[model samples]
Structure formats: C-alpha cells, structure tokens
Target: MSYSATDMIFDSEGYHQDFLIDLYEKLLKPRLVEEKMLILLRQGKVSKWFSGIGQEAIAVGVTSILQEDEYILPMHRNLGVFTTRNVPLHRLFSQWQGKINGFTKGRDRSFHFGTHEYKIIGMISHLGPQLGVADGIALAHKLQNEKKLTAVFSGEGGTSEGDFHEALNIAAVWDLPVLFCIENNAYGLSTPTSEQYRCEHLADRAKGYGMESHIIDGNNILEIHQKLSNIANDVRENPRPVLIEFKTFRMRGHEEASGTAYVPDEDLAHWRERDPIVRFEQHLLDRGILNWDWAEHIKCKIKQEIEAHLAIASEDRLPEFDETIELNDVFKVTENQYFEISGEISEIRFIDAISDALRLSMRKHPNLVLMGQDIAEYGGVFKITKGFVEEFGKDRVRNTPICESGIIEVAAGLSIKGMKAVVEMQFADFVSSGFNPIVNYLAKFHYRWGQNADVVIRMPCGAGVGAGPFHSQSNESWFTKVPGLKVVYPSNPVDAKALLIAAINDPNPVLYFEHKALYRTQRQEVPFDYYTTEIGKASLLKEGTILTIISYGAALQEALKIIEEEKIDYIDVLDLRTLQPLDTISIFASARKTGKVIILTEDSLFGSIASEISAQITENCFEFLDAPVIRVGSLETPIPFASILETNYLPYQRFREKLKELIEY
Candidate 1:
C-alpha cells in the first residue's frame, strides 16, 4: 500500500509514539553526516561521498529491528545503518580520511570497514557480491542452529547481476535465514530504473525463486520499522529467505564526483518533496510527538558530535607502509607448521585423492562446508564428491545453482564468520564468470583489512581430455598474477592430497587447480592419513647438474616421462606445487647448479606460468646460465574438441623436442 505524509501510521502497539521521535532523530544524524561529508568532499578531506539522503529510512528502520548479534551487510550509502550499529563518528571520519585510526588502517578510503565484534560487514566496491556473502553467513547460522538472521543491502542496479539471482535461489532452495533488501533508488549511476529492468517491480523476480517478497514505502520510517521487525522475527523463527524491495529515490548523484545532470529536474523535485527525513520529521510534529524545539536540539546535538569526531579524525596519523610484509603474513598460516600423519598408504586416482583430502579435512574441522553445482546429490560431474552427502548430510555438502559469482562470494562470507568453505567450480573456465569476487573481494581481504578469507576454490583445469574451450582450460596463470591469492597445481596423487589439505588448513584464499585430464588417468600411492605439503615450496622430483626442468599440474608428467625415456642423467625436475609464491630460492639454486633451465606448463605459450618461471630464473641466475631460459607450453588457441586437433594443440612430442633442445644447448 502507498504511504503518504499525512496517511502514514505514527503509532503502533509494539512501538510507542515516542519511538517516532527517536527514529526521526536517528534519520537526521545521517543526513547531517552526509552534508558534512559532502563539504569534506569539496574541501579534499574525503575523496568521495555517496549520500543516502532520501534512503536513510531503509537503513535506520531495518537496523532498528535487528538483534545486537545479528549481522547487516551494508553498502556505501547506508550511513544510517552504520550510525545505528553504533559505529563511532570519528572512526567513520577516519576511514573517509584514510587515517591509521580507521578500521581499514588507511588501506582503503571508502565505505569498506567492518567489525567482527559489531557483526556488521563493510561493502566492497562491487555491489552484488554481498548478497551471496550474506547467504553464506545465514547458512553458517542455520548449520550452527543459531537464532540469528543476516540482512544484506543492495541497489536496484545490483539486481541485474547474476550474483543476485544466484544468492536468492540458493537461499530459497536451502531455506536460509537471510533478508535481501533492495533499495530501488530509480537509478544505477546515470541509468534510470526504466532502462535497468523490464519488470514492473524488482521484488516480483523473487516469486520465480519461490521466495516471499514485499514492496514497502521506503520513505515511511515508522511503517518500514514495523514491517521489517515482523519480517525479521519471522525469518529468525522459521528460517527462510525473503526479498524486500524498498521503493525509494536517490536525491543525490551516484557520488560527489558525479553531478545530477542526467536526472530530470521534475523527477528530482518529486523525490525532494518526499525526502524520508523531512517526511518523518513532519509526521512526528503533526502527530504532536515532537516539536520544533526538540527537533532543533536533536539536530544541534548530532551536528556537534559530527564536528567533534571530524576534529579528532583529522588529527589521526596516516599509515606507514612496511617493507617486511612476508608471505606467511598474507597466508595467515606458517608454512613450516608440522602436520602429523596417521593412515595407511593406498593407491588412488587424482580426483579421488582430492575427494579424500576434503573428507579428511571436513571430519577434522566441523566448520568446513562444501558448495558447488550438482555436488551434493549428483556427487559432482566427475564423482570427486561421490557419497559426500550421505556422510556429511545436506547441511554441510550443499548443491548450489549455476552461479559462480554467488558461490565464491558465499564462500567468502562464510570465511569471514570463521567457517572454512571449499567451493568447487564445475569447470575451470567457468571461473571467468565469477572473477570479480575472486580478484576484487576474496583475494584482497587479507591485504586490505588483515582479514583472512579462509576459503579454498577447487578449479578442475587442463585440456588434454578434449572437453573443448568451455570445460577444459588451464587458467592458473590468470590467478598467479593476483597478489594475495595462493595458486596451487599438483602433479601427482600424493601432492594433490597433500596440497588440498594444506590449502584447506591455510588462512588465505587458495586457488587449488585440479587437472581434469588427470582425474582418473593416473594412480599413485597416497596416504590415507592427514598431511600437508608446504604451500610456497617446490618439490625436487629428480636431481641432476646439466639442466633444470620446472613444471607442474599435467605438464609435470610429460617432463618426467621425457627424462625417463631419454635416460637423461643430467636433468633436474622441479614440481612447482604453488605458483604465486614461486619457490624462487629453490629455483635459483637449481638454475645455478644446472647452468640451464626449461619451464613447462599446459597453458597457452603467451602469458603462461612457463613465461613467469623463465623470466624469474633468468633475472636471478642470469650470470650462471649456460644457455637462454626456454619455455614449453600449449599452442595459443582455444582447446579443440576433436582428439586429433586437441593432441596437435597440446603436442607433448613437440614439448619433448623443446626440452631436448634446452638440455643440449
């Protein structure tokens, strides 16, 4: 139902008329804060400002109903939510100023700060990813049988993203305790709502997911508070997701840098007249719950608080960069941590070894959860997670919709709440769809905020089995370039089990690339017990003096076969289990000893791991090199479907010739 200023309900049995005064005061604080922030923006004190001018009621109303321990995932414009969450004014000012006293310690200078103690998550620049993260937190609460629910905020623009659809679907199917709040502010940056979606109301999309949906008058603070309180309680008592669309308007531009030139003057005037804060304040006065004297007093108190905090925040020092940032600091776990082994040795395929490692990890860590498409009941397309559902039950092993972006972010959200999530990408190439969450959010968490996203993304990669371009791809090189991510590509069943175990236990985000080609092709003796290989250390498979062969994943087998068949006595083979923190000491030492080097990988020749290894070795061991560093990799083309074309594409014989030429050089 539509709510007008005069028609709005000011009194309810649950909340007295006095509550309207409190809500109006709460709404005024953020508007004053935003006005101050806009001034700071003009004065160069803050780099940017996103005003929640007309939309303050959405945050204040929703937060008013939330329990102290319940979480709220807020966006940049949700200043009202931050205020309600008891975030100190000075801390918010410090974050805006990029000061050391800020929550992010000057690493970020936007609305990107969250406190685990406060149960609030700061927003990443990307809009839609937080929805999935909320789903993950809600999932954790559900599994733990907690009475808490999670609320995530997004805008109308975010509904266009695949993550939004995916998160809503997962939450609906699994019956998660999550409230998806969409603020339809009529525009996404410069694009109007009419241009963004064809649907009449964004909430209508929730019906397709079989979820409860509501459309509320966002400008009515009292009505919003009353409705959200009941909805929040319902979600907490009977765990299921609901999507609420706030019919609001954005009074300001997207940011201070962006002017409101694109918005029609008439439309702006219409929303200006319906300003939630003004409307709420007038309603309170008309109801005789507040007077001009009380309103002025509240405004003065809030303005003084903002100015006082801004003064303190202005004096805060800037963060100094430290040069001694080590790999272990980012990874969170010490590389040299001792892992005790206990089970018998048995022969197992590459995929089964990975599956066994996951099982062992889950059995040991109760917080570990598995999520992927068709993974729970279907046991995954490759049967790697076969029989996992019967063992761990559906709560632990979940089957997600085909939404990689949502899946990865959900895993990230779970990680934030001290839950370890193992997210399986059905195919490695599909990672491109979810690359934003992986690179922008998950990979940057530890570096920016010193928070470890203790999640492992299992990517089934490589192209030898002729699955074509869509299914088969060696995308490890793409992630190896990202700074905070750990890239692991195992060569054998033993390393597969060991590395997966290590990645799971590690506190950083690890991209564990399991070769689809080697799933069932190779078998080796793998320990039944738990063990972890060093994440940043390379293993010396064979030792020699004349030449050093560096390879990993499927290419390591080719390197080994060539060495054995040719009876090469002067060759040393190094399996680079982890790619990002390349074992440079071992690589340089091996290069210096051998006097020659060859790097091999299954990826395309251009911008491959082989290129990285070759460049690094040449730079460090240039004086000792007897010959130029050589690289052997697949041809630079899409992986073909036909066996003959695929074989020609990934020619092992040609790779062997390259290795021979390097050895004899």
Candidate 2:
C-alpha cells in the first residue's frame, strides 16, 4: 500500500499509513547508505563519513516536508537531506569518492560543496557560518514578497558559536523567513553537551530575542514531520524566523573512526534501544502496514542501490592537475561596459564623490542594498549618506545591528540570489571582527562551488584624523593576499567615485578603501553622471623621464603635493587604483623608463604594499634600474593622536627627504 513520495499525505494522525511507509523508506536510505559507507571507509574505497545513524529522522522529516522552492543548508551528517531532495545516487557516491563531476570537482572532499541546482548548500568545515548565509537567502525572499523560506541545520554544539547568536539576532530583528534547526545529537566531536553550554535548552534563549522557539523529539519521525510541517508553513506564510531544537543522541561515533568508548555502555545501550530508524520501523509493524519480510526486502533493495552507485562512482574520473585551473577558478572576471558620465563636471570632494556614486548605483540597481552600523538616518559616521534614507527609504539604506560578522554574511547571502549589497565598516581596523566570512566564506565560496557572491565592502582606512589606534589604520594590504577578493583604492575625488562604481559592477567581491584624511581634504572635477575607472589599471598622474613615484590613496596625494610645492619636474607619478591584480605592466614600464623608482605607502614600511612593489621591480626590471628602489611609509607603531607625533609617523614626514635622495642616486 506504500505510495510514491509525490502521493504522500499528512492528516490529524500525522502522515497516512501509505505515506508513512514512504517516509520510512526515506529514513532508511540515509541509514543504509551510511552503513555501506562505513564498510567502504574500511575497504579504502572512500575517504571519510560522518554517520547520521540515530538522527536520520531529523533531516528526512524536515527536508521531506519542505517545498522544492525553499532552500536548505545541511551539515555533513545529513545525508537524508540529499536523498530526500533526490540528488542522483551516483553523484552522491561520486561526491564521497572525490570525482571530477562531484559538486566541488574534487577540489573539496565529503559534503563541503553546494549546488544551486539542488537548492541545497553544504556546510563549510567551519560549522556555524552557513546559518548567516541562510539568513541572507531568507532576507531576499522577504524583500521580494516571495512565500519562500530557508532551513539551516546545525549541531547542538554549533549554537555555542558567536555566528549562531549573531545570525539569529539579525534574522529575528529583520523578521526574515528562516527555519533554524538544531539537532542535539549529544556530542560535539568528543565532548558532550554538559561542556557545551549552561542553558537548559538552546531554544529557551530564543524568546529573549523576541523570536519564536520550539523543542521536539528528534527520534520520533511522525512527530518531527508533523511539527516541522506546521512550523515551516507558518514561518513561510508570515515570514518570521523560528528556532526548533530537535532532541536526539549520536548513536555512532562522530565519524566511524572515532570509537564510542567515551560514550558509557549504559548511555550507548539506552540510545540504541531508542534508535530513530528502528523505532519507526517497529511503529510500521505495530500498525500492520509493513511486515518483517517486506522490511527486509526494503533493506535489501537499498543496499543493492548503494553498492551499484558505489561501483559506478569508482569508475568516475579524477580532475587533472591543470596549472591554469588553480589560478582561474578563484574569480570570474567580466569585461565591464563603460558608462559615459555626460551629466556635469564639477569640483567634488572625495566624500561627496563616493556618496554620488552610491546614490547613482541605488537609482540604477533597484536591488542594490547598503548595510552598516548607524548608516541609515545617521547617514554614516562620515555623513556621506546624510540624506540617503529619505531618498532611498530604510529598506535599501539599512542600519544594521553591531554584528560585523553577521553584516558580512547577510550581504553574502543577498549576493547569492542575484542582488547587489555594499557593506560599510565603521573603520577599516574593525574588519577583523568580520574577517572570517570575508576571507573564508565570500572569498573561497566561488573557488569551491563556482558561485559568485557579488558584494562590495567599503573600508574607511588610514590615519591623520586623530581617531587614534582603533579607528585609524591602513589595512587594505591584508586582503590583497587573499584570492577571490579584489582590492581597490583611489587617490582623489574623480578616481574615488569612478572606482567605487566600477567595483559595484564587478562579478566578484571587492574591497573599496577610502582614506579618512582625503574624504573632505581632496577635491577635483569629478563627473556628476555615471562612469567607472577600470580595476587593475594604474593612472599616470604626471609623466616624466628622470624617475617614478609609485603610490596609492593618501600617499599618492602627498607625493603630488611635494612635487608641486617643491617645483620638481622630470618625475613620473603612477597611482595604482587596484591593489590586487596589480598593474605590473605599468609599474614595469615606468621602472624600465626612468631606471629609478620610489614606492610610497601609508602602511608600515616593512611587509607593506611598498615592499611588494619593490620586490616586483627588483625581479622584473633589475637590468634597467640605475638606483635601488626607496620606500617611505608610516613608522611601525600604533597610530597616535594627530599631533606632531602623528605627522612624524606618516609617510609624508619623509617624502620630500626621500625624493631628494632618490633623484640624486
């Protein structure tokens, strides 16, 4: 009497007997597949497996009830999620075998890959980050008025992460449609819940955030399916975040290799007696819906299917070690369509130029969103967005809570669904708070799964405002070494507006560094209309034959001032607008032309962008050089009060002196 999944039905007594068998079959797939993988692990046919023996009910029950349009973020243990989604069995086997056709193309192993085709994103090795990404997708659903929701699963231990708290708070405050599922499988790796948290239940803390919370029996398939169906439906319709704690126990080791010796004999026996799959099977038998012979036949059919797929996966090809693939997979660079700024040409301040660019971008891309701390009515700390909220309204111009990590992940989430997001950090120094998602999540996500998270982070960097240690720092160099992240900085107002607009149009994540000192101090004839400066291209400020001054941001302004005030000619000034994908062609040509070079930067002299430029010149243009490259930068210490002490610490303090020495060398 068992029917197909399409015919499954739920009534007051939970799923009807016919559909109950269907749910039972769904639960059996993960259990049987995990059992087969354990044998494969021992036989050296597979690398690793995270068993979900006792917790199959949670993944199967929740995923089975979810609509096909809804998205889900599943942890490694949730094989049932994939099986329920009907992802090809051969592909699942291929994924575990690290085949080229696998989701990550053998670049990653186990369940660390995501495919948009399935609407199922796998978790990173870092457990709690995906919760925030889920929030991003749900936020997109809410803004578009779509009746779609996203469900994300984490272990009982993952709730202890700062990301978990931050994601929940952001979701609740925004009233996003997200189902936060926590499967309490008792142990986090080796440690138990006793050492994880003091809260009676993770769900109990959700009410404090004004979010709905519930607890369920994770081992009961019927109860879990019934509760999740209603809860998922309510949240999907009303669009609010809900946290559900499903109580279960880890029946196997975290992985097969980790023995269960730590789990006392009595506890192991206790949970084994209440195994989710076993209980569900017994329930079918008691209801006279399934007999012992039919149950054995079902298990046999699952085993045969697993073995057949494993054999096919064994024949799947491995990815070749192509040198270009390593470089190419990091980012997908697209040729930008140049926009002509024919509106007006007026002298604009650096801050106004950035403001103008964002204003125009918002008007152009209706999906463009701005997120930061106190950026809405306060118009940001710099007042660059002073009238933005009134013009664009609050939804587009958002003032986020002080959760920098959450802010970045939410933007990442927004980017996943074809929306543009710009995240503003209060200060460049505070990027450390949100560095994980930027480097690990946003940066490598494309490399791992061929997905583009198109978001821009505007970093207000540099010293000289008397903002002191915490607020003042030139930290743009930090992201330059990270692949899949574009770094751009502009010297003056014209270039600042151009570069900001250009970064927004790029298909990858970009970090736009705005120097605090140059915000109001520098003014130039910037286009009032729309235009973009090309990334990875250097602008020649002044062309000369004697020598070249290589710099960017505030440092370039200081170099130009020295040349004009001192009445020096015969010097080439090149402002490198983009830091990553450095304009080496321009630098090499300039170095080869003059046979002398001076690399100036606001970051400290040692291990700075200056150091990188100097190395490139020495290696690529050694024969043409007449003088060793001289570099000037801030003294290696925390930025101090912008008094005489600060002046001495800045690169300008020695620009004139260094220029004189280098010119005569």
lDDT by residue (tens digit), candidate 1, 323-419: 5654334556545655766569999999889989999998999999999999998999998888999999988998888889988988988888889
Cα lDDT tens digits for candidate 2, 273-323: 777787778768877889999999988898888888877887899888888
lDDT of each: 0.87, 0.88
lDDT of 1 at 319: 79
RMSD for all candidates, in order, please: 1.8, 3.7
Off by over 4 Å in 2: 1-14
Clashes per candidate (backbone, < 3 Å): 0, 0
State model 2's lDDT: 0.88
Would you give me the overall lDDT of model 1? 0.87
Estimated TM-score per prediction?
0.96, 0.97
